[model samples]
Target: MRLLALDRFTWRRIYWILLVFLVILITVWWQPNRTFPTGGSLARDSANPQQVKGAIQPIPLSVDLDVEKVALGEELFRDKRLSADNQVSCLSCHHFKRGGADRQTYSVGSGGVPGDINALTVFNAGFNFRFNWNGAYETLEDQIQATLQNPKAMGSQWNEVVEELQATPEYPKLFARAYADGLTAENIKDAIATYIKSLYTPNSRFDQYLKGDEQALTPDEKAGYQLFQDYGCISCHQGMNIGGNMFQRFGVIGDYFDPKDGITQADLGYYNVTKDEADRYVFRVPSLRNVALTAPYMHNGSVETLEEMVKIVAKAQLGRTLSEGDTDLIVQFLKTLTGEYLGGSLEKLALDSDDDITS
Candidate 1:
């Protein structure tokens, strides 16, 4: 009996020792292999293909979509008849030449009324987990419907919009080609959203660097990218879209709004939607893709220059004061994010006038 007891104790001790060893092994393995939220697996270094690093992934060059739907949707996107006054269209605010956003602090709405918030870029918007600054809509279709009905936007009833489109000589034919349903409100919204999804701008220099092109980025820009990761900017902005994957408070470290300026309803952010006090000033993190072309910055468009915006965001969000030299380097890295759209660089397209754009 004594010998049997001794054997039992010895076996139990060995089992516990193995269990502890397994736990340690797992901890060590997971620590290195674990991925950040929305970040891709570590990529190989451009210079040394064997060395793995980086979290950001390249945007896909193209997405498969129905060509007929895309063509019909593009027409609707530019059509003024969708608005109540027949003066505003989606393109009025989302300009292809201007990085898919109008370069205005507040977009001029249908009757010359300014909007409550800055217009986010339409390019790469489909990559976002949710739509709008407050995340009020879950799907692109929902956002489109709301925008159409919103008094400050298109301001048109769905019935009227459908009727007008059905009456238009070209729209019926376009709708028939895109959908068998032909000119329903649902089909119209779907077509428009489909086209918006096709607006992704890919093949940026940064994407080339990610895909193992050593010469894509300058030495300073590469250093800036390293600094971006080291400084924890990647925590919220480390996805294919570089942002738009998460919601974060505008000011994580300190108060960003001025008391004297007075808070508007728009400043309430998700709080207006949820009516929860905790949600105040919380917003969907805007994508940094093509950010250099779409300025002024922030939800309110308070910061005019990209450099000034970077300084403000660093101080408010990261609680760090960046040196002038560091700021310049980071800005240079950001500029490399501007990508190709419609077989042309967005920077080159921005120089084209509205007339040229329509032509």
Candidate 2:
């Protein structure tokens, strides 16, 4: 009887091990695009790739730029006088070396006040028809003025900023050279706006591939692009900037925010601008150029790695939870979007690997 009992117990243990192995095998087999694109180009393999073609357009390598205006804007963007305490400038939040973003969910501004929302990249500001996450300002100059006046940002009115610049002898001559109107508040906005517009980045590997350079991207990257399109990421994130073209509701398939998690007024999104119920949670889509270089993704900057961000976006926007291997494959494609900085090269920016995104 003892011998019979031992044999039964051993068989039970073997049965359990086989069950576990089968589960893993079935899981892998069930999920399509587990490690790469299922087959061919997205257009050929996908049921409707032509419909997606208009959703995303490639960026050009370069654009006609005004060198003088961009130079002045670059200087003013770094000069701390734009802030009330002379302690903050645009560069404080948007670092050139850091994909034109501070990588902070909430950036500190004038008077050491933390900004309410995440700072968006200024790298491709010119491509967007509207500015700011809420599309609050229609033009970059308007956005500049809002920043200069917002207490949490520059924290000063135009008169004080203009007066300070007028007293500075060097600024007067620089302004005169850039604009016929010279160093007035309007001209300041114009020159700075011109410069900000010139901050466009291009010549990424993906762009080269779009320009008919077949070898610009690797096999994995190409698969990722195919998955990117197949998964409907191209729906909102299209156009020259790969996003920043229109507004979309934050949680299309699922509610992403909870007031219990310390939600603030900024979370209300375009509702704050229009005061309409339908406008709630509507925000301008951010550009994906240099996305690999810019970490801590999302408007809140809450998501950590690119893989995790893709999963969250898939769930919230498309109502799908991707397999781990599929997520990694899509991330491989996004890395190809990192491009050369306009007028210079961009070093791969550091990521905040310590982010706690368990929630």
Candidate 3:
């Protein structure tokens, strides 16, 4: 009798398990349309650009640079006094010699704290639509202010920043030459922004080819360019900088966030700022200028190699995987996008010292 009761209890438990599975199956089956991006719920092709229909026009390198403002801006760009610890400067992470990025997975900021996102290259950042991956700041001034205060970044309060700069004997004169009112926060931001504005790059091999110099790019690069457009990378990345004009989800046709990485809050990209459901997982498309130099790509600094980046982009963004040869050709094509600054050097501006500034 005890053995019979034991078997009956086990059968009851089995029945309950089956019932629960059926309920779950019904719930999931009813929500068939709610599958992930690659499952066809979201507009993958809409997010992946196909052509450079309208891109921001590239500025000619021959155009005269504003030397005074650029010089003053260059001083501030390298000034560590702008930060609280007198260590971190704009150049600390965005190294010009390294293609505007420190090439690390994450950059060390003030007090040795690390930034969550990788720094974008300053080479052609001026042409981007919105600043930062989240599109937080609209202008360069706003971005500067945010960077100065963010504890995970420069960590200096705005007032403290101004006070430190004010105490410096060399900044006022530089500010005076750059702006109508010298050394004020507004003018300080303006000068820095002006300097960054002057950091535009042009005269890349791609630009030469675009201007009708067919021989500028090699055969492999030309093939890569064709694949780049044919596979639809040009749609979003078409602009002068080859991107930065719009926002896109990191994975257009897939959920890029791997739960196995212990990820909790779905990287709710621009949606965090906009509070719109559709904006979820969206980030500002970064410029590919000097892409060959920038390593540890993406906002999270997840991907390390450019070749792997290309593969991921091809599969997730383009809804297809590229052949090894195609990827190699595409990489070759991307290499030609590196541009030259007309009259300035990123290395010089980044490594400038406080003693170099004029009062």
Q: For each predicted model, how many residue pairs clash, with residues at least 3 apart or on different chains?
A: 0, 0, 3
List, residue by residue over 1-359, the lDDT tens digit for candidate 2.
99999999999999999999999999988864432221123333346766666565566666777888879988898889989999888887887666888777777788988778778888888899799888888998899988999987888889999999999979999999988888999888887888888777787888888888989999988988888887777766778999887777787775777777976778778898999998788788778888876777877788878988899888877777899888988999888887776445565433433243211
338: Cα error in model 1, Å: 0.3
Clashing pairs in 3: 49-235, 49-236, 50-235
Ranking by lDDT: 1, 2, 3
lDDT of each: 0.84, 0.80, 0.75
Per-residue accuracy of model 3 over 1-359 as CA lDDT, tens digit each? 99999999999999999999999999988773333223242244344443133333554675355788778878888888777788888888776767777777778888898667777888777877788877878999999888888877788887777777788778776677666777788877777887888778787788888888999999999999877766767666756777777778877877776768755332677887899989888877778877877778887778988899999887777678789999999999888887777655433443455353321
Error of 1 at 303 (Å): 0.6
* Candidate ordering by TM-score (highest first): 1, 2, 3
- Return the clash pairs for model 1, or none: none
42 Cα displacement, candidate 2 (Å): 14
Instruction: Give the runs in model 2 whose Cα sits over 4 Å from its true position.
Output: 1-46, 348-359
Candidate 1 minimal-lDDT segment of 10 residues? 37-46
Could you give me the TM-score of model 1 versus the true structure?
Answer: 0.86
lDDT by residue for model 1 over 245-303, one digit each (tens)?
Answer: 77777777778876788998888888988999878998887888899999989888888
Candidate 3 off by > 4 Å: 1-59, 62-65, 264-266, 343-359
